[model samples]
Target: MDPRESLIPPETLPDLLAPGLRLISVGLNPSPASVAAQVYFAHPRNRFWPMLNASGLIDETLSPSPDSMRRLFEAHRIGFTDLVKRSTPGVAQLRAADYRAGASALRMRLHGLAPRAIWFQGRTPWSQYLRYTSGEAPAAVWGLQSQTLDGVPVWVTPNPSPANAAFPLDVLTAQLASLANWLARRP
Candidate 1:
């Protein structure tokens, strides 16, 4: 897939979903596999699932099936989104322009969702978002948090892309377990 092509694969790039979506989880962008798989974080090497398990966010280990993820979202009030709606195949396919555009647009989404907490799975997206704002809005940790951001909270976990070297399964699971532990405590 040509990253620069204006024609994005109609292969299921979800639009700006309902702002009613509560726990909005934001990704940096889309990969071809994710687009093709029609599931966010579907890549085999990605650590997203294990992280969720380690974090204790979910009660059971889920198969990387689209249905399971969707079920979890609906039941848990979690939502999925990307900083960029367009597919770029890989990070190298993205330009600085995409980050800037995504950042500007993402802020509007935050206000719209009014989510109790906003979660990002990567440093690029979170660090870039921080560029446009200031002063520790919430407990922005590498894992889950118990704080709020301007009333709404924000948490970040490791990006599960096979490309993100920082979060191998162990690290990723520990991080996700943090989220699970938090979820366990919530009313």
Candidate 2:
């Protein structure tokens, strides 16, 4: 299927979601490359998909395409969404209002879905999310936290954007491995 026909407008990628998900991975927002391609983590250099596979969170080396995402929800019991749905060249282009609105929407969405876990791909959105949900700033920490959204566990991980050279692919892969371990231990 033409991606355009299967997804939201190219300017805004739709959430890849389903009920009763084992995990719901949340990104800060869609990058311009992702928006243009109408695929999540579409940038050639983005490590999101590769890390997921490496960590055994996903069994297949999936591409950032509509079919793969559908399989992620249906077969893997995983879903993808973003704190912000808007497309921008970079996160630097996002404003405070954008984050506030995104956080609010995400809170409601998570509360309703009540996934087993909600994983934030970066510290930025996770911080904003804590503020949005708790009405106070949290000393953000990477990895699983004691926080929960509507009873769903919250996890934070390093951003996988190519621009984030601070955490190399190996580091991100390890982080994802931790997330997989957490999920495995869940009752």
Tens digits of per-residue lDDT, candidate 2, 94-168, equal: 998898899899877776787889889998989987787678777768888877778778899999999888998
Q: Estimate each model's TM-score.
A: 0.78, 0.91
Candidate 2 global CA lDDT score:
0.86
**Residue 104, model 1, lDDT:** 72
lDDT of 1 by residue, 75-141 (tens): 7667888887678768778776777787777766666567656778876777766654442333355
The superposed Cα distance between candidate 2 and the true structure at residue 13, in angstroms, equals 0.9
Error of 1 at 126 (Å): 0.5
TM-score of 2: 0.91
Candidate 1 displacement at residue 88 in angstroms: 2.0
Segments in model 2 whose C-alpha atoms lie over 4 Å from true places: 1-9
| Residue 88 lDDT, candidate 1, scale 0-100 | 75
Alpha-carbon error at 123 in model 2, in Å?
0.5
